[model samples]
Target: MTALNSKTITLKQLAKTIDHSLLTPDLNEEDVKAGCELAARYQVASVCVKPWDVRLAAGVLAGTDVKVGTVIGFPHGSSTMETKVFEARKAIEDGAVELDMVINIGAMRSGQYDYVRKEIHEVVEAARGKALVKVILENAYLTKEEIARGSQLVEEAGADFVKTSTGFAPTGATIDDLKLMRESVSEKVKIKAAHGIRTLDSLLEVIDAGATRVGARSTAAMLDEFAARYPDRLG
Candidate 1:
């Protein structure tokens, strides 16, 4: 992987790559608000809050470049197709500009490729161009071949991005997984890395591996480090 010139990358550029994640189940309304505030302050790419918070987050991030994003079929992708579509539609109506949807992991692992593809396609259709759809493959439960096949399915379904994990899985994004996903899809399909990205070095590793976006709860610490290293680039 070719390295990103850390010296040349500004804080704004790095911030734009992050989706400040606030998906923990125990978080309250105040927590969501604070997370949105943090995202606004740093001007990150988006704030990926829980589905219920999409309207609130949208209100907070209005007029800013920071987009409002939410998940569909979430940590587990067992939800029925109709439910997932409804979730996507409601999120979009609530001002979510991005939707990170989980694929049917059990079905995918069972080699139900057609079912998985159809589900993703339905969700994409439901978004109706209102939001950029990201299909999460949950790589922790899949082999390399499955990951590759899943990426292809996402591209075929017309989703905007292929993602690594749901962060509720046993493990998160890896350099190898990111590279494999990148190779599996064309340049038109972007890649997002979520979970366990806690430091500047780790974040850069994923970026070099081909991830354009990352989901993380450690936004402040990571950006603070970048600020310390490149004070002039802060924006």
Candidate 2:
């Protein structure tokens, strides 16, 4: 596991951008609870776990500043729109503060732009202003044009954030993709550069390219290294 030890030198600054993750298939309720505890201890931005565990995380994190987050149609984005929407609404009702929904790769590849748009909007609507909606574009599977188009569609669908990958794909977030995504969206929308952001240089590149958030499981180690390297910069 990659640690959050970064050259930034400050826990407070690093935690603000990290989204503590616990999305592996083998992760059980106990693991999720432990992850939530770690996130709370670190005071990271949020704790992202399986959709089924959103309520549990919320219950554990209640009355705290840490937000509860989960993924919809995760790992695979091939699920029907109805299913994704159903999952989104349920997760929100279960106390999820953020929804990260993956886009259907086949539909996007087939040039079914409108279909993708509607799918995202469906989930966004289901969120009902309770949770922030983030559309994961799976950038590795698409061409540059497709990435740009996906970003536009996500923006049009009223999503709060546009994400790079689910990390199950062949490739993860890249600097080029981050630039394209940032360029494609409105300034009001946030850009999250996730997927294999294991190093300080890599994470900084994304932030410099306008990524306001990062999904990472290695918050603890990365921030530690960052703090050691740049002790004076961090609070």
Evaluated with TM-score, which candidate comes out highest? 1
Over 28-132, each residue of candidate 2 has an lDDT whose tens digit, in order, gives 889998899988887888988898898899989987799999999998898999999999988988999898999999999999999999999999888876999
Give the TM-score of each candidate: 0.96, 0.93
Model 2: weakest 10-residue lDDT segment is: 1-10
Q: Please report, as a residue range, the 10-residue window in candidate 1 with the lowest summed lDDT.
A: 1-10
Query: How well does candidate 1 match the true structure, expressed as C-alpha RMSD?
Result: 1.9
> Top model by lDDT, which number?
1
> What RMSD value applies to candidate 2?
4.0
